[model samples]
Target: MKKTINWKFTLILLTVGFMTAVQYNSMKNPKERDTRDIWAVRHELAVEKQLHSELLSEIRELDKTIFTYKSLNDENTGKALTETVDKLYSQAGMTNIQGTGIIIKVKPSAESEAFGIPVTDVSPDLLTRFVNEINRFKGLILEIDGKRFTTLSSIRDINGITTVNGLNVSTPPVSMKIISPSFKDSEKLYSYLAASTIHDDFYIDNLILEVGKPERFVEIHGSPEMFENQFLKELPKGE
Candidate 1:
């Protein structure tokens, strides 16, 4: 009985050893071979991530390049943008269409103040001098008392109505529209006119002045070639 039990125990130990050896061999050289596959998959994924990052970076650079190209192509991009916005404003009926410039409406003071002063306070010579002064600053005169500079003067003898320089301009209080490049120039001209000796003895009461561009006028086309070199330098490569 003792020999039989020892042999049984020895067989059990040998079976356990053989099972352990099989498991070790299987781990060492697996049939499915998933060990190297896991490492390879991880490496591939890492490479793919790196490649994706690189592609994304390159795409960002491409977007910048496209922006630069567009900016270079449009020399008047800022003006174009402004026009677009203005057009939108017009479409919305929020834009006021009027001539832009300084409107100097100089009228004679009340008759109660001075008796000798004539109703037509602003003389033609004084008007001419004012116009000349405005011209010195490159200001373009648009209208004088509802009469454009291009039109001819009219006279009405029957009703004692007379017009000078195509405008039914009154002597004391004259209304004129002068367009200058800037409000500063307009204000300067206005100050000079107001302080001049020509208007010293006159009873000037109402003086209305405003500055802005006219909505409707003959469009003046500027030369693009005037800034050709600047445009060229601003142009994109190969454009």
Candidate 2:
């Protein structure tokens, strides 16, 4: 019993000392630590939104051109043209199908504030895991903070600010919209994430994930820039 008590006492000292050293290091390099300017991040996001609008304008022009081509084409060519249009819309996220889906909102937990943990921002790693998990469950469409998710979507520390597809999602209580192919898939996602406290330890310990009820007729917009930015031509068959 005496030996066990000594071991516990020594472990406590080592743990306290390690935490104190960490605190000292943080104080030594305060600027090197968390110091992202929210204003700059917001301005950059506005620029991105303007860019998306420009791309949307160009897509509208192309749609008009395609419509004219369809009008003059033979029946088979017209069918192919229609198919191409549908494919582009699907990739661009303009599909207006009625579907059941879920919205997940994340915020810093009360525990984090109580313990003085700086977790007001949702880190890029946590966002990435959320995206990957939703995709794994066959998520048909996704959006973060009103910014559509595409093949080019990414969550990263941009200019010291965590951003999702050029928009700052670092702010707490950001919502992630998940549109599943079916109602069942939406439920699966909720169950998986709900039961994954251990897996999402970093997020759960520092933040709160609020899962919402599945709803129908949820709308998801696709990125117009997805097609506007694509120019690589496919090689002809057997060329």
The model with the greatest lDDT is: 2
In Å, residue 46's CA in model 1 sits off its true spot by 78
lDDT of 1 by residue, 1-239 (tens): 99999999999999999999999999998888555777899988887886797689869966875575577546777665676567544433243333335566666554533554435344455555555455545435455565544212223322343444433466535566665455565567567666665454333422222323332332222111211234444557788
- lDDT at residue 144 of model 2 (Cα atoms): 81
Q: After superposition, how far is residue 106 of candidate 2 from its true place, in Å?
A: 0.4
Clashes of each: 10, 2
Residue-level lDDT for 125 in candidate 1: 51
lDDT of 2 by residue, 4-46 (tens): 9999999999999999999998888786554559998897787
Query: Model 2, poorest ten-residue lDDT window?
Result: 220-229
Q: Which numbered prediction scores highest in TM-score against the true structure?
A: 2
Those runs of model 1 whose alpha carbons end farther than 4 Å from true positions after fitting are 1-100, 110-118, 150-162, 201-239
